[model samples]
Target: MSYLFDHPDKVMPFFWEHVRLTFTSLLIALCIALPLGFVIAKYRKLQAPVTSVLGIIYTIPSMALYAALIPYTGLGKTTAMIGLVAYAQMILVRNVVAAIQGIDPMMIEAAKGMGMSKRQIVFRIEVPLAVPVVLAGIRVATVSIISIGTVAAWIGAGGLGRLIYQGLNHDHTGKIVAGTVTIALLAIGADLLFRIVEKIFSPRTA
Candidate 1:
C-alpha cells in the first residue's frame, strides 16, 4: 500500500502492461476458439477428440508452456501471449460448443422454415443466444489470465509480475504486496465488468 501510493509512476505502467497483455491475448484466443468451436459443434465426431486435445494443452503447466515457447518465440510479449492463448482454448472452446449446442433445435428449425439461410440462422439466432455463455467463459479466462499474467514478467513480457519478482529478489515486502493487490483488484474488476456485459447480452424475458 505504501509502495503503491509512494510510487505511482513505477507501479502504474506495469499495471497497464498487465492489462494490455491480458486483453490482447484474450482477443486472439477468442478469434481462434470461436471458429474452432463452430466446427466442433457442426461436426459431432470432432467434438470429443478436439476438446480432449485442447484440454490436454490447457493442463500443461504455465511455466512449462513458457519454457517450451522460449525456443520458438525467444521470450517476450509474443511468447507470453501465445501461452495465454493456449491456456484459454479449452475453456473458450468448450463453452462456445456447449452454448451453440444448447440453442433450441426448434428455434433453428423455425428459422429454416422461415427461409433463413444457414449463415443468417447462425448469426441471427445461434450466436446471439449463445452470448451469455460465451461471455461467462470469457469472464473466467480473463480473471485467470490477469492472475497468471504476472508470470509473463519472468519471460521479459513486462507486467506486474516484474514488480513481484524484483520485490522478492530485493526482500521488499511492500512491492510484493502492492503487485499482488493490484492484480487481485484487476481480476475482480474484469469479472464484474464481464458479468454486466453478460447480463446485457443475455436473452430477456417476455
Candidate 2:
C-alpha cells in the first residue's frame, strides 16, 4: 500500500514488467488459439480431441508446469511464456469455438445464397458476428493470464511475483500487499475493459 506510493520508481518497473509478460504470452496464445479454434469450429470431429489435450494441459499446476519445462527451456521468460500459453489454450480455444458455433446457421445459409465465397463469408459475416463472443473469451484469458503470470517470477521470468516472493523472503508486509493489490487491480481493470468491449459489440447493442 504505502510502499507503492512511496516508491513509485521501484514499483512501476515491475508493474510494467508484469504487464509485458502477461500480454506477450496472451498475444501468442491468441494467435495460436484463433486459427486452431477456427479449424476446430469448422471440423467438429477435431473439437473433442483437441479440447481434451488442451484440457489436460490446463489442468497442470502453473508451478509444476514451469518446473517440468525448466529442463528443456532452462527457465526464464521462455519457460514462463510456454506455460502461460499452454494454460490459456483450453479457455481461448473453447470460447472461440463456442463463439463461432453459436452463430445462426440460417445467417450462414443466407450469406451462401447471396453467393459469398467461404473466405468472404468467414471474414465479412462470421468474424463481425463473432467478435463479441471472442472478446468474452479474451477477457477470461486476460484475467487468468495476469493472475498466473505472477508465478513466472519463481523461474526468473520476472513479474510482480518478485515482490511477493521478496516480501516473504525478507518478512516485508508492504511488498506483499503492494503485489497483491497491484495484481487485483490489474485483473479488475482488464475485466471492466473487456466488459465495455463486449457491450459495445453485443448483439443486443446492434
Candidate 3:
C-alpha cells in the first residue's frame, strides 16, 4: 500500500508499456488469424492440419519461443510480438472456426437458393452471426497476450514485466507488487472493454 502510494510515477509508464504491447500483439494476431481462420474454415480439408499446427505453436513454452526468436529478431518488441502472435493463433483460430461452423446450415442454403454469391453470404450472414464468438476469442486472446507480455521482459521487450525483473534483481518488493497489480488491472480492464463491445454487437435479447 505504501509502495503503491509512494511510487505512482515509476509504475505508470511500465503499466502503459504493458498495455501497448498487449494491444499491438492482439492487433497483429487478429490480422493474421481472421483471414487464416476464414480460409481454413472455408476449406474443410485444411481445417484439421492448419489448426493442429497452430495448436502446436501455441503449446511451445513462451520462454523457449522467445529464446528461439531472439536469435533472429534480437531483443525487443519484435521478438515479443512474434511470440504473442503465435500464442494467439490457436485461440483465435479455434474460436473463428467454431463461430463459422456454428452458423445454421439452413441459413447458408437459403442464401445460396436466393442466388447469393459466396462473398455475399460470407460477409452478410456468416461474419455478422459469428461476431460474438469471434469477439469472445479476441477477449481470450487479449488476456493471454497481457499475461505473456510479462515474459517478454526477459528478452528486453519493455513492459510491466521489466519492473518485475528489475524488482527481483534489486530486491525491490514495491516494484514487483506494483508491476503485478498493474498487469492484473490491465487484463481485467481489457476483458471488460471487450465484454461491452460484445454486448453492443450481439443481437437484442427477447
Candidate 4:
C-alpha cells in the first residue's frame, strides 16, 4: 500500500531486526540441541527424561517464560534469546534424536566395515543421511521462533513485533499490516530456503 511504500525505511530496519533475532536464536538452539540430542539418543536411559523436560518447557506459555527469565536476564535480547532457545529445544532435540536413530543399520554397518572410525561413521554416514529430516526440524523450529519472537518486543527486544505493538497502540492499521505481512513472508521464505538446503544435502532418491 501507499502507506507502507512511504515508510519503507522505518519498516525495513524492523524487519531485519526480526530476522536477526529469529536466526540468532535458531543458531543458538541448534548448537545446544544437536549435541544434547545426540547424547540423549546415544544413551537409552536419558532420552525420555531429557526430551520430556524439554517438551514441558515448550508447553509453558511464552509470556510466562519471558517473565520467569526477566529476574535474571531483564527485558531485552537476552530474555528473548532464552525464551526462543527454550522453545526450539523440544523440536530440535526430538528431530536430531529421531534422525540419528532412524538411520538404516545396514548403512552404519557398511561404514564400519569400510574401516570407518566411530566419529567418521557418525559425521559422514549418519549425519549426511539424516540431513533431510534434521533440516525439516530446523525449518519447523525457525518458523515457530519467528512467530513467537514478536512477543519479545513486549520486553524491549526491538523487531517488527515492536511495529505491530506500536501500531496496535496507535490504531495504525497500515503499520500493523506491514509488520504482519513481513513476518508471514519471512516465515515462508525461511521454510523454502531450508527445504531447498535439505534437498541439496539429502541422498539421491531412487
**Residue clash pairs of candidate 4:** none
Question: How far off is model 4, as Cα RMSD?
Answer: 1.1
Task: List, residue by residue over 22-121, the lDDT tens digit for candidate 2.
Answer: 8999999999999999999999999999999999999999988898999999979999999999999999999999989999999999999999999999
Candidate 1 vs 4: which has more TM-score: 1
Rate residue 57 of model 4 by lDDT: 98
Q: Which residue runs of candidate 4 sit more than 4 Å off their true CA positions? A: none
Predicted structure 2, TM vs. truth: 0.97
Error of 2 at 55 (Å): 0.4
Model 1, CA-based lDDT: 0.93
Q: Please, what are the lDDT tens digits per residue for candidate 4 over residues 1-206?
A: 55568999999999999999999999999999999988888897999899889989999999999999999999999899999999999999999999989988998899889999999998888778777888989999999999999999999999989999999999999989988888898999999999899888777869
**Model 3, stretches more than 4 Å misplaced?**
none
All candidates' lDDT scores?
Answer: 0.93, 0.93, 0.92, 0.92
Return the TM-score for each candidate structure: 0.98, 0.97, 0.96, 0.96
Q: What is the lDDT of residue 154 in candidate 3?
A: 95
Give candidate 3's TM-score.
0.96
Which residue pairs clash in candidate 2? Answer: none
Error of 3 at 106 (Å): 0.3
lDDT of 3 by residue, 1-206 (tens): 45667988888888888888999999999999999888888898999899889988988999999888888999999999999999999999899989998899999999999999999999999999999999999999999999999999999888999999999999988888888888898899999999999998897878
